[model samples]
Target: MTHGRQGGDGASDPESAGGGASDPEDPDAPTPSDAFGALGGETRLAVVRALDTESPRAFSDLAEATDADTTAGFAYHLRRLTERFVRQREDERYELTDAGRSVARAVAAGTYTASVDRDPVELDEPCPLCDGDGLVAAVADNVTEVGCGDCGGTVLRLSLPPGGYAARDSDEFADAVDAHHRRRIESFDDGVCPECTATVSARIEPAEDEADHGASHRDDEYVPVQTVYECETCGADLRCPVALTLLDHPAVVAFYHDHDRDVRDRPIWNVGSEWRERAVSRDPWCIVVSVRLDGEVLVCYVAGDGRVVDHRRESREEPSARADADDSATGTHTDDSTAVSTDDAETVRANDTAESGPAES
Candidate 1:
């Protein structure tokens, strides 16, 4: 009569028997029941199977798919599954919670790979704070009010997922991270005035004057060491140092921390070599830009504890601004004028209105 144990009849009620408690092969190990009592019933199993497939399904969809005896019946099972952390709902949609999905996928995959097996950076479970499904599609346009089917919760603003692409460990990985960081730093330079752009040049340089490091003066005085590039086009006379904004991205942090031995205690300390290699191994193309064109070019590094600073202006023309402009103009707009004739015109009108507020009446 226990919730999970079966009677001697050999054909016990599926509801009473523990469903996902443990591997049938290993009764003594930690079972799904120990984590949550979700794997405990037939109806709940059906509910989970339904969610595992196309998710963000409505309650009606679940009823239709599962052929539940009643909506109340479906709700009963869903509630129980929820109590066991098997599923979640967002607004009207129902989907597996992260824990639910993780388990569901494990069961589905037949052989679940342990977290240790993969690059430590590859895992991003549900939002620990809010257990919404971690998967989200990136939209070039603005997104609003996304719902998590598992938790039935609504997120008012949708954020782009952390750049999750990973770099494999190889000769090329270091080059890729360095290249990505360079592109991000160059992007910051492109946004500034020509003068600062020339000076910033999107590169980090050690202060030429040792006096700038405060070594000439008392050691107690803090002298700025890292230099960021600034955009001269923005009329900023002073350029700022490139900040490591990628650290804010959890995936990027994992790349460094997970591959700790490779980056730390290096024989020859080359940020370009060791850090870049480590960065790419976590997730390729994970750079985040956090530079602004203040009076002085201001850039914040985001790879670790985020920080801000100013850089010296070196010149007026940024090294790569022209190439970026050419790429923007030609790369994505091959047939711009022809393509904008019909639907694009309407979009242009809407955009103009959004930007200018009807020409100020």
Candidate 2:
């Protein structure tokens, strides 16, 4: 169970890098080994789970939150988790950074998905490998384990869709699939802006689509329309311009290419996490699009192996429960001891996630 590294440098206590403990640190200094090493253990991840779900807590509190005896063993894992982006200490108390939150959320989500599929796989269910969609056999006969470019799950064999053929030897194809899997987070199709209750659409065209005929020269002024997550109650639109910069992220573009290659000819249109994110990136949309007419919120996610996963309705009870529990145990209410600057916290968060927002589940 190796967690992938997509973000910036590994987690390190800024204070111990020959720099003062309180000094703000740069995010690019840590190495991949440093980052992965920090998060490679079960105990470290457990420590992370303890901090992320709970509010900021003192060392003793963290041990309690995890229901682990406050032994030397628990202390060691806590120290290691702090070194990783999974947990950060403030005034000697711990909490989850944004990046840590993302990773924990994904890991927890992946765990659930795995559990859901466990019985089928154990029972030798029909192609439970690809959730029964079937896979295109990989060209390499000896490659026993392959990650699904569509869902991110490991499969015993590559299953191709009907009428689609993969050129196994093509490096380009492999690269394309790798890229897709890397950026595989699920997206919202009906996000209603928190402000505007209306359904947000990512269908805005490039600004250059209707250029001025009289203009002598056209700059690259073709800005993609900004996507807005509408707030149904007040009609305020919230949007992130970066969300529209789809191809800007190499991983995302690669996702488009992979699915297009494997399922291009089929009448069935494949919709996965990558595809959903691409839509979110291109359209002015939300992750949980609101269907005001039905008073429903749409949610989506990516599976471990690259499949687009989805959940529905207004509440994420499971995630909310997990987050709430973590927060309750570790969350500290004090501003002085528990407070963390947004910049420092975000840096910690980004280090763990910079690599895979394109495919975040």
Candidate 3:
């Protein structure tokens, strides 16, 4: 009998018999590793960089641009990059794919450059901690950071694309950074990674010491808390303040808009501190937020699953004079301080929904 590895039925495995080579007609599925591996060689990386000019280059022109000593070597590397990072057109010219262009831009942006000192870009917003004109933005080691010069606390810091800072003025660049940060926070709050669209888990917790400045500033005595979103699939992490996260809610935006205030026009640090008092319960499992905007008081209850379970609005008015007098005479103030349980809160939400309409998420 011939000795061989076999299945339970004593038949030889077809994979073993064929030496496990994938079928060439299988459409050549490419993975993320394959894309990264395409840039492993310096010659291959130079080829990608040469194609970053936003125009296709002929094979001979590209080989010349990359300074290839041998055409055969260049062709071998180019073949490896095909269908993933680089693509050849019908006219026999080659161009970078979207992934290839992104990688090329990153390389051009010096994302791997060593950390160096850079001047800070002045911002229009004032530092909430110090009440000074010291808020500025800067980029170093591929990270964009904004902070107060006097307080020495970084208000925001994030990694960006290598070309993130090119061809933009200070104000415009600041706006772009802010927008990027806002979108990321909103995406994370919606239980998805903005970068990879992977499922994310989030929780509200006190900010780390580096990210918080409560101890040094008297006005910022209240310890700041952050809503952290971590992706289970991609391992991407984002941390934003609880107030900032809630500010993106439709109801919150409507409330601000009704009061003739545009929340988006204000800086996050300014708005976050103002609304921090509204966060009554910042429990990671369940959060209860109450905001008094103008003459209306809005109460929002967020469940552990990161959904707004109940939201209700009430006018900020006192009880009738007679009721107040009666309560005063009985040594009990007629205050709307009743503790709301989950069931009662849900009931109030239902009643509010039936009376008016459900608040937008």
Q: Best candidate per lDDT, number?
A: 3
Cα lDDT tens digits, model 2, 1-361, are: 0111122465533332222322136655455456556776666777677766677778777676554555797877667666646455457677877657766775765532232111111211223335554333243322212334445565432222111213333323333333332222113123443222344333333323335443332321122333323332223322332222232233333333543443222111122222222122222122211111122223332222122223233333443454455456656321111122333233333332345433332
Off by over 4 Å in 2: 1-28, 67-70, 86-91, 111-361
Q: Candidate 1, after superposition: displacement of residue 182 in Å?
A: 14
Worst 10-residue lDDT window, candidate 1: 277-286
Clash-forming residue pairs, model 3: none
| lDDT of the candidates, in the order given | 0.36, 0.37, 0.63
Q: What is the C-alpha RMSD of each candidate to the true structure, in Å?
A: 24.0, 22.6, 12.4
Model 1 misplaced stretches (Cα beyond 4 Å)? 1-35, 39-46, 54-79, 82-305, 315-361
Write down the lDDT that model 2 would get. Answer: 0.37
Candidate 1 lDDT over residue span 4-50, tens digit each: 12346745444433445465576665565566555665666666777
| Candidate 3 residue lDDT tens string, 104-154 | 877887767544334688887888678788988787764667789888877
Q: TM-score of each candidate?
A: 0.23, 0.28, 0.66
Q: Candidate 3 at 75: error in angstroms?
A: 1.6
- Location of the lowest summed lDDT over 10 successive residues in candidate 3: 276-285
